[model samples]
Target: MFTKILIANRGEIACRVIKTARRMGVKTVAVYSDADAGAMHVAMADEAYHIGGAAAAESYLCYDKIIEVCKQSGAQAVHPGYGFLSENAAFCRALAENDITFIGPPVGAIEAMGSKSEAKKIMEKADVPLVPGYHGDEQSIEFMKNEADKMGYPVILKAAAGGGGKGMRIVWKAEEIEDAYEAAKREAIKGFGDDHMLVEKYLTKPRHVEIQVFADQHDNVVYLFERDCSVQRRHQKVFEEAPAPLMQNDLRARMGKAACNAARAIGYEGAGTVEFLLDEDGSFYFMEMNTRLQVEHPVTEMITGEDLVEWQLRVAAGQTLPQKQDDLSISGHAIEVRVYAEDPDNDFLPATGTLTHLRPPQESAHVRVDTGVREGDEVSIHYDPMISKLIVWADTREGALRHLRKALNEYQVVGLTTNIEFLATLAAHPAFVNFDVDTGFIAKHENDLFPKREHITDDALALACLDVFITRDEEAQAQADWSGDPFSPWHSTSGFRMNDDNHHELYFVEGDDIITVTCHYRDEGYVMELPGGDVLVRGERDDNGDLAADLGGRRMKATVVRHGDNLEILVHGRAHALKLFDPLAAAEGQDEVSGSLTSPMPGKVVSVLVEKDQEVKEGDSLMILEAMKMEHTIFAPMDGVVADIFFNAGDQLEEGVELLKLQGE
Candidate 1:
């Protein structure tokens, strides 16, 4: 075994490899960018080095810097840990020339499979099943459109060197093909430096299932079953599971054998994954082979009781295969959910901010958490927003599903918006529960799944109101007591009365409308029984001025205060500033206003598509903002002139920043 190894990556995967290396008594070195100086993976390594700037091109992608760190640290081998230089053939050759082992497949295999077009040709020769598509070297605009016509509408244009859904587009019509092809090419060039693309017939209902293959130096290859990565958004996997729920014994055997053949055909060594797009008719086509460990490898590990990273180390150290195909068996069902810093309601756009609160559930015998961040860490726009991967295992698929849902529900994160609610809804969906969905599931059911919630219960509304009241009451009591006047009229027992004779009127605003509510005290607290006999209680206060009560069986932290006859409350991190009406004073007047346009989140303005005095229609793109590595276009709300342009391109704006103004006639 090697005495030491250097990991040429960062984040969860880096930490993952270090853990296995540690178990095998191998010291590990970690490399980090400026953004990850205090990251979890850095703290987990035996030795660490700072590479370059926060951007990937300057830091993780710098092969020379990584190689130098390896040599200086005396690392016997270098583990690419999947993303940065994992599949770079040049990096592999450099390590070999320097007498440092590259713990991955051979350089030739990586080169053959690194490009999608080349991989398709290689797989064709290997007799691997392939989808019908165009995989040639033609890049002309007319040629691509011609190929799409032959392949029929709904063809997928994928970047030859794409991963992580960066350079991919699905065109459903001829008119959209030209624009989509150009956009995909542009993004491909920017993201991978390779503008090569391949057009394929889009699968109507595709299930993304991949086989985990392992091989040693002696040409021994074995398949560790499959993972169903059908739950996806924007062509990216959101949820993954091992031992596909509805798979048959015969299908599993055939796919496993095919996976083994695919790996052996390339003389593959170390850990690799053979991805397949399974059709509704049980036929599977080779998608592409990932030349390194997959992001969702933990699900396979959980089911097979194997440490894949440890296998990579052993294979690279001149070891033979430890087990044959039959010896490998999945003992249980395992599922993994990728928790990202994103807003699912807004087309799953990535988000960036300081993670004010991050509390991952405790890992037990059946649950595993692979994370690369801490509570106070900043999820910047410079890197991937994946916060962590939560994995759960059980003897049965249903058991695993139940456990996973419980874990997700218990997970709590604040400060930044996430996809927790969306994930929960997905887990509870009937089609998902029955394993009857595929890649097209989200697109087909997006309306039902992403609908805006209406009909909020009156109980919840009353609770919100009581929350405001308690906060104001506490504030009023504090102010009166601070004056050091025992006879302050604000502290009179009559002030706490709850009957209609002494009822208090509270005014609060929701959106563009203001609502008035009346309340009174009852029993040990205040009770506002709705017309349907639903009772809401504002319980007695504790020493900390918090209401000691439960709302819908969930304990709540709240403060209620009263200013004169008005009540205000703080609940669930929001302060409800309210207006109170005194019996002695006249009612307050209301003001009418027109609608305003404000940014939904903090981001940098990337473009101004409209100028002042321009007449626009509703939904016209007014400006573009780049935040969390994705571009969002703000649109005109109504048919009007652009009254104002708040910020120009390259300006960083906070959430709710007004980007443009519209005037009403």
Candidate 2:
């Protein structure tokens, strides 16, 4: 076994690899970019080296720099933890030339499965089930259009070198093919530096099931069951589970054999995944193969009680297979949900800010949190916005899902938006609970997940109001010697005044609406003038700093987390973000800023489609901004003429920066 190895990636995956390497009595080196100077992985490594700038192009993608670091650190091998240089065949050969072992598949295997079209052809030759589509090398608009026409409507365009949902588009009609092709090409070029694409038949209500296949240098291969990644959004897997919910033993065996065959056909070594699109009728077709560890590999690990990273290390060290196919068996059910720093209310847009509070679930024997971020860390817009992966395991699928809901509820983060609430909602939905999931699960049940709300609940609003009142009192008494008792009733309540009543009014902003609430102190309770009607509420803080409230004879418990003027209160199983409103500021900033297109997140302007005074209709594409490795087109909200263009193409922009102004006709 190698004495030391260097991880050629960052974030959770690199951290994950380091843990296993340490367990195997191997020292690990971590390479980081400027943006990750204070990253968790760098701190965890026995030795660390700086590569380059914050951008991946200047850092992780620079294989020469990584190779030089490996030589200086005396790392015997390089483990390309998924993404970055993980699947780069050239990098693998470069390491071989330098006498450093590459802890992944050989160059031949990578080249064979490097391109989607080439992989499809190889799979067909190997007698693996293949999908009906055009996987040709002719990369022209005319050729692609004709191929889509022959494939009929509802075809999917995928980048020849795409993975992780980038450079993918689905065309539902003939007229949409041209635009879809162009957009997919642009994204492909930007993401992978390859504009070549292939058209595939769009599967309806298909479940994304993938087999975890492993191989060693000794020509030994085995399949470790499967994971169902059908729960997706924007073609990205958000949730995954092991041993697909409705899979039968026969289907499992067939898929396992097919996956193994696909791996053996390419002479694959190390850890890889064979993805397939399983139809409702139990028929499956091969998708592209990922040549490294998958993001959701924890599910498979939980089911088999195996450490895949350890396996990768063992394979790279010329060790024989750890376990034969007959020795490995599924032990239980496991599920994983990706926690991202995004706003679910705002279409899951990537968010950037300081992590003021990050409290992951209390992990136990059955639950685990794989992450490389901590509280007070900055979630930069320079890379993927994934915060962590929450994995849970149980004896049964239903039990694991039930634990998933509880885990999400226990998870909490402040200072920026997240998808914790959104995940909890989906986990409890009827369709998901009943095992009726697919790639279109989110779209098919959008209404039930994000229901329109008329008003905030009375309890929630009351909690917010109380939070504001307590915060103000604490600030006022910070310097005073008001008995160090934190939960003193005297400090929280209005002083006992004979023949005098105290009334307090406060305003809070939930979203765009400002709620005005009046609190009148009574003998023991308080009368609140809410928007719905008058209600009596009583609340007090305990020594543990949790609030117990009684609103109109109903009891509820809540905890308020205050960050400056912003408050995040947890009631029941959901969390709400509210800001304390100031009447003076509201009056000064009452004018609505309309008729302008602003960048949703910090990004570079890819293209400006209009000039000053250019007329545009509603829904017209105005500009394209690339951020978080995704392109977002700013569109005209109404029929208007562009009055001003603030930024030109290739200019970096901060979030909420107005890109262009429009004057309505």
TM-score for each candidate, following the candidate numbering: 0.84, 0.95
Residues 1-665 of candidate 1 have per-residue lDDT tens digits of 89999999888899889889999999999999999999999999999999999878899999889889988999999999877799999999999999999999999999888899999888888888999999999889899999999989899999999887877889999999886887678667767789899999998888999999999988788998999999898888999999888899899888888888888878899999999999989999999999999999999999989889989999999998767887888899999999998888878887778776566767997889998888889988777788999999999999998888878866766557788767878887888888888898888878767877443244445665565556666667787788898567766433354444555555554444455555555544555544345354655568855566664345665555444444444344323444443334555776433546777767788778888878888888888776543446688778888888888988987776667788854
Best by lDDT: 2
lDDT of each: 0.81, 0.89
Q: Count the backbone clashes (under 3 Å) in each candidate.
A: 20, 0
Displacement of residue 547 (Cα, Å) in model 2 is 3.9
Question: Model 1 — TM-score against the truth?
Answer: 0.84
Evaluate model 1: give its lDDT. 0.81
Give the total clashing residue pairs for model 2: 0
lDDT of 2 by residue, 1-665 (tens): 99999999999999999999999999999999999999999999999999999999999999999999988999999999888899999999999999999999999999899899999999999999988999898988889888889988799999999888788999999899888888888888999889889998898889999999999989899999999999998788999999889899999999999999999999999999999999999999999899999999999999999999999999999999899999999988999999998877767789999888777889997899999999999888888889999999999988898889989988878778788888999999988999989899999999998877546677888878766666556665663445576565555547355676688788888888888898887776778898778888877777757688888888887888888778888776677777887887655545557887788888899999998989999999999888866778888999999999999999998888888889999
